[model samples]
Target chain A: MQYIYAALLIYKSGKEITEDSVKAVLAAAGADVDDARVKALISALDGVDIEEAIAKAAFAAPAAAAPAAA
Target chain B: MQYIYAALLIYKSGKEITEDSVKAVLAAAGADVDDARVKALISALDGVDIEEAIAKAAFAAPAAAAPAAA
Candidate 1:
């Protein structure tokens, strides 16, 4: 089976930001430097469908089949 | 400023999958395990807006101010 690695790009106000902004923040925060990797990541972000990605990432609780007795 | 770390959860067919699936794949792949972190990540994914997140992540080429003469 294929494998995928994902992460969250959270903003300061608890809002989600674009991958670019996330990268910028990571750079500003002094994460390791890998120019090639950064470029690849940016390109991937550009190509990704964020909405779909989120949907895939989200978890929904299973509905109860029957109510509990009082 | 607060920092957010994000990753892409890729599927076998080159399609995006949910975080749980991604986590499962990763687990299957023998990546390091962190149950607490996984739980937090799943919860965060539940709260995110994928569409908005993608829009934020997308990059649009700046319209050219002027075309160069041939």
Candidate 2:
């Protein structure tokens, strides 16, 4: 019975979105606190651009399925 | 001005968790696919008790902070 929890992050003032910062946000959001999954997600984001990631995910999301029939 | 999309649903076998099967699993997981806010998160999960709403959202997601500084 695995469960998935989802969240959005807003960083403290001028800090760069680092793995550490991401970790901090996730911790603040209290998500998957016991596992290293949050850390992994943060690390996976390294060197990647944030706005770009958001755009990509946002776009890809719409392709998951067609609107249900009426 | 706002965006949040997260999803997980496994059904089509015995069908019961309605709101039209969680609006057909958020329109088959293309989530927020033009918003109705996934039909208000499946009618606020009507009549509640899906494992106690996943144990109160996995224990209020660990109390939203407290772990960072090591």
Candidate 3:
């Protein structure tokens, strides 16, 4: 949803993903900001590797799967 | 967000997180399923450590942050 997208946007911008930053992004997007959800997201993302998660998302197809040995 | 929740439910159930499973979960929840989004989520989570990711999410607080030296 917009909450996760907001976090991803902050991640992509190389800015620290804090509650305030996420709220700012959501606000700029004209999305109704939910404070509790934003807080939960920031907490849930604690110690998560945003770069790795995003990289995985970028590989959005079975073609990106590892090749089988011939 | 329901899509992500569906995937998480599959994950938590110790079942394989396939397109079918994800769709089933969403369907059971009476949520309108989006095929493309489910496909993308499966692809995105292909190499992700879901256990590790969930563990990180379990850490949901600033108090979970590393302690500052007194």
Give the number of the best model, judged by TM-score. 3
Model 3 - which docking category? incorrect
Rank the models by lDDT, top first: 3, 1, 2
Q: Return the lDDT, model 2, position A62.
A: 28
TM-score of chain A of 3: 0.78
DockQ of every predicted complex: 0.07, 0.04, 0.01
Q: What's the distance in Å from true for residue A70, model 2?
A: 9.8
Clashing pairs in 2: none
Error of 3 at B2 (Å): 0.6
> Taking the tens digit of each residue's C-alpha lDDT, what string does model 1 give over B1-70?
1112323323213333345544443443334546566666667667676557754434211111112111
Write model 2 residue lDDT over A1-70, tens digit each, in one string. Answer: 1112222222212244444544443333333343466556656656766567656644443232223111
For model 2 chain A, where is the 10-residue window of minimal lDDT? A1-10
Cα deviation at B52, candidate 3, in Å, is 0.4
Docking class of 1: incorrect
Query: For candidate 2, lDDT tens digit of each residue in B3-70?
Result: 12222222212235445444433333323343475456656666766644433323322322323211
**What TM-score do all the candidates reach, one by one?**
0.31, 0.33, 0.44
Model 2 chain B: ten consecutive residues of lowest lDDT: B1-10
After superposing all C-alphas onto the true structure, candidate 1 shows an RMSD in angstroms of: 17.4
lDDT for A22 (candidate 3): 92
